[model samples]
Target: MIKNKISRGVLLGILSISVDGIAGLAIFPVLLYYQPKELAGLWILLTSFSALLNLAQAGLGPVITRMATEIKIDSTDSDIEKYYLKVNYCYRIVVFLVFCICALLYLFYIRDVLIKSNYLSSGIIVWAIMTLGYCLKIYATKNINTVNGYGELGWDKLIQIVVTVFSNIAYVIGLYFGLSLIFLATIFFIFSLVYLYGSKVILRIFVKMPKILSRKKINFSEVLDIFKQSLKVLILNLVSVIVLNVDILIVERFWGLNVIPLYSALVKIVTLIIAVSLLIQQMIYPYISLSWNTGVYKKARDLYLKGLMISLITSIVLSALLFLTAPILIPIWIGYGNYLGAKVFGPLLLFGIVYTHFHSHVSPILATGKKTYITPAITNGILSIILGLLGAKYFGINGIALGNIIASLIPTIYVVISTLRFFKTHSKYGGLANGEYKR
Candidate 1:
């Protein structure tokens, strides 16, 4: 069973990567063809904002993965339905709240800034449409995560590939039609709805009997337990969001919109590599919860190490490829304006990617529950931001990349090592509840 799951996970993960890669490569070309250079930056900015907004729902998926794994392991079908509805209720509430928050922010503040900066031609319309779509996407995201927790990584990735391929096709159509950002945003929203339903059909058919996270019972205590763990995992996510994305935001604001297209093209491609790096951990994430629950720490640890080794080696090879071709690739792919800076941006960002990718594997192990990983993550995230801001202030785009790389290594070699070691130590002793955890 383990071998089957792992094999299926790899197969589906590769398919997901290929389709997503095609989509990622396809979008930039279409965007470049349709929009001006500055607007490309706006595209990058809005996408990054969408990613940031996703942080609002950060803890929801992992919590689902953890809870669903527990219920599945115990063969507790009764608990499953109740847990599903209860958490689904909370998820809907979260979606609404995030929707309102983004709506209000755009209404009062960001809309004007975008117009003043001339990034958004439709201003509030674009903001409103995209914000709502992002929220829906955020909401739909849990379905994929929930299925993942059931130890169905292959099925989860299949669902993910479907949504991704369809959405990017929708995006490409919008570009070909010469739609404004507003129309594209509308297309995004429509696709979100499609996948929202599409995920249901996939989960129902593909998942084994008794889907747990879609429950009717509102188990408040259990719900709160999930929430608390999610909250901590959310913090750990900060480390990731910052390291992968913060540079684009920094460049967008400080260096002005024009420079962003240059920097962001490289960032976008590299972000794909980072996403590939993350696939290893994400594929095994549910197993961390499952094996931990089953008291199969040795199995979990061994699988995790194997995944980590694969990701690390993959990232290193990809980084070398980026160095050779990114300079040449950027101008060819996006067309050159001020994008010459990519020559410097690629190598430094790849340096950060290595550590960041290594840490991605480490994080899922620590983040299966609770806030154990939060402080160090929060500390490193903050430090990265500080250095990023200071670097952007003094050194421009290159410095910001440098800031993230430097701060990324700090936690990779030092802070997180001790945590993993301790966790391993305790796992051998008995189980988590019986283990002594020092804050």
Candidate 2:
């Protein structure tokens, strides 16, 4: 039954992300209506801040999913209860600490930017509240993925759709009533609280609060090991943020901030394609982790190939559609008067989409064990910075997209070749029989 549920869960994930994309699309109207010149600055700040928050997440998402899969396979309900409790507690604490540190940093370092931009001071306060609420939401959402339960995913998606609707309603109200940015931020925080409360309700159905709270002492050594193991992924994650968002930042520095809304609009469309790739990756991760944990390397290899095929087909079709229709669709969506076609940016984005699909889908395969993590992290970081800078100089907006494509391409090639070579060498030596091979 659980095996049958994975397909449904994957579909739910796609729908969930699509809801988020719709919300993103809806926000463009507000950006275009008010303060178009400052749109890029806002995007830069939002992305940079969000990236910092994610850094604190520290790759625990996959770890939690792996742990959950292992618990489910063991089929010991009691063990599952204990494991969930310990993990959830640790996850919450980390999230809270991360929010606090980030809020403090923003208060001290980035306050002037906020003030000068005419954003209300209350916006900062609301951001802190939203961050705390999201921490809870993230933990609850991960539990659904770990247990292969799509009910929570479906529920989350429904709530997101509602939130998006409410946000748009609030945007209209703000514009009609002349509300300040602080009020908009407050509305956002209120919506976050609604989602967090919903998450708690869903979480209670599968796990009691007491059971989800850690009673066993969490050792610093164990935490450190987790941090160490996840550090490479964390670094890889940071590099990814830079590669993806740094273009807007560079553009802001060189060009005026007004160019950002145009750039942001283009990037958001590309990100929708990426969201689908990420959904496939998320679904594949638990399966890969389970297969690897059981030493079924062949099964893992087959799964990766299957994901790759799916990714290729979907990416090509979507990329082609976006490239061909961008001239018409973007203008209709954002109004032709305000939008400009970044023609070269579209093709470069196609490459980046393919590169991102492969990288996201294959990362878990490459990160299966401690020994394999370094290659991806190192290669992604080095290439991201080098190509990012070069792309900024050589191609401007398109160059940034090209740099991201190149950055993702290198590690993907390495992982694919290495995995296939390992499989081949193992098959030749009869190591395939036991699923044991020298890497």
Candidate lDDT values, in order: 0.70, 0.62
Q: What TM-score does structure 1 among the candidates reach? A: 0.89
TM-score, every prediction: 0.89, 0.84
- What is the lDDT for 417 in model 1? 73
Task: Report model 2's TM-score to 2 decimal places.
Answer: 0.84
List runs of model 2 lying over 4 Å from the truth. Answer: 39-44, 75-78, 104-109, 115-145, 148-159, 206-216, 422-439
Q: Which stretches of candidate 1 lie over 4 Å from their true place?
A: 107-109, 118-121, 208-221, 341-343, 354-358, 367-371, 431-439
lDDT of 1: 0.70
CA RMSD per model (angstroms): 4.1, 4.2
**What does candidate 1's lDDT look like per residue over 1-439, in tens digits?**
7567867887888788889777877687678778886676576667667666777775677777777777666755666667667667778877886787797767775776688677555766777887777777777776776677777777756766887888888888878888888877787788777767766776676556463344245757876766776777677766777767777767767877777666766776677677677677777777766666666566566656677777777777787787777667767777765455654566565654655554665555653453255666776788789998998898766787777777767666655576467557656775544322211
